[model samples]
Target: MTKISVIVPVYNVEELLPKCLDSLVNQAFDDYEVIVVNDGSPDNSQKIIDEYYKKYPNIIKPLKKENGGLSSARNYGLKYATGEYVLYVDSDDYVSSDILEKMYSLGMRDNSDIVVCRSYAFSNNNLEKIDNEILNNDVFKRYILNRPSATCKLIKKEILLHSELAFFEGHYYEDIAEVPAFCLYAKNISFIDDYLYYYLVREGSIMHNKKYSDKLNDIFDSIDNLTNIFINKNAFDEYKDELEFIYIKHLLHAASLRFLPYEEGLPSINKVCEIMKEMFPNWSKNKYYKKMGFKYKIVCSLIYKRKFNLLKKILKVN
Candidate 1:
């Protein structure tokens, strides 16, 4: 069997698809297959996929399907992944050549259910490394309580199959729902300190698109789903602190985004603030909350206080 199956969900990112595919095809690791799910991209993304498929037919498998969202594309690709481990790569992003080799080796050596590595965030001509400190066996806690991105991880296929995990379809911020579940279900996890993935910061991306606020409810739904998962496993008591922290942080983020210049975003922001209050009535007292930067602390206080006008003014200034 292949050592890893790299799943790339392609949408309308025609301009950025080649760089992503090039990085994958030129990877130092050869014992892996690249499953490119063409999510009915309206652009020339399929043409690029076809080009790569022809060039590296043995390693690249292109699956064409109707336009489902990111979650659907990833879930579709999962069905045909034949490797022992799976790695998700966004079509708009690229990775270091040695990423697969290093991550795959760590997974095998540690017999880990998941292997994570550092990543870089790039925009225009600037690059910033995101170096997350990984604590022992606390991958789930760290993920929910801190950094949460599905990329830069080599996940054992068995854990995903056994957990019957699938990204929530037709949702924005689907990774918020799916990645934490993987971390929670993982038995053993490993981390490599080296920076391996390049996350492109593009203005047109889902996260940057202000109009995507309409689907903001999906973020809360995903968080609720994660909470229920912990409860079902009777792990809630053990992870309550981390879970509460995550809820508060994520709610604040959503609320901040909605508190922007757009009027349509206000309703979602208000809703998120309500949920945040209900989830953690004393969120302001959280140690993590207290440790937050002055600006963020102010934002949190304003949101908790339902001071939208002040929050908007602060956001505009910042």
Candidate 2:
């Protein structure tokens, strides 16, 4: 009889909102409330929400708020949520029919603070599943090394309330920064291999949308925040090597994105090189750091900075 509050942040996702809501409504789980936060979307998303609000008056509660970012919308929804367990489902994404019931049952049986499930990512022509578990006995280690997404999971409301965990305002990659910290703070965590969440990959979504030069910086900041949480908490020294691997992979991806013509001023190649050097001085040892053709990797290494000599040295060593 555990009540769950499903929070869906409604932005300008009018086209996909109905499908998302329909999936939720059709779920086998009955003891749940849906809280949809309307974050000043300019589109007819509000109209659609209103239609549903009228139809399902008792189960659906709509909270209208001015244009604050996603974090603000979620924080606003939290205030009105009355369920013992909380789940976040983006307006643009939909879940499998049994996700809520399965996640809730798992959490209840395990007395878990956080419950995670496998997720499917769908593009127009391709689909992929991400369901890897970290081998180390530590939950935080598993999170840092793999299973880093927020959408493929469920959490206990009391855990968040007791820890006072709130999303960082006006930031993208907020989940990346917050999810790891939650795992670190949690003592009871459980995972199910079953698929629950489906991330429909629109070609032009925000995360994959218009290239912004500063996007790399946002990504770096997220990694830096996640790293700081672990360091400050003094969780375990064994994670340092694994963390460096994660950092290198993160920087490489960010640095690659800078090569595209994003609107923001091109991040100084030097700044990226500087961060790569400071954070991951030696990348060859990191397991996930892939080995590319010597010159290609070296050139990529130098794209962050204008130091041809350093690139030369790396090229020579390789």
State each model's CA lDDT, in order: 0.80, 0.72
Give lDDT tens digits, candidate 1, residues 1-318: 889999999988998899999999998987999999999999999999999999999999999999988889988998999999999999999999999999988888888988988889999979998753434355667655646677888888877674436787887767777677676688787878899999988887555665645665577788777777778778888877777777777767653564455676667777777887787787778766666679777877777677877877877733
Q: Tens digit of lDDT per residue, candidate 2, span 16-72?
A: 999899988888898898999999999999999899989887778898999988878
lDDT of 2 at 304: 48
- Clash pairs, model 2 backbone: 269-304, 269-305, 270-304
Residue 13 lDDT (model 2) = 95
After superposition, which runs of candidate 1 have C-alpha atoms over 4 Å from their true positions? Answer: 132-139, 162-164, 210-212
Q: Give candidate 1's TM-score.
A: 0.93
Span of 10 residues, lowest total lDDT, candidate 1: 131-140
TM-score of every prediction relative to native? 0.93, 0.83
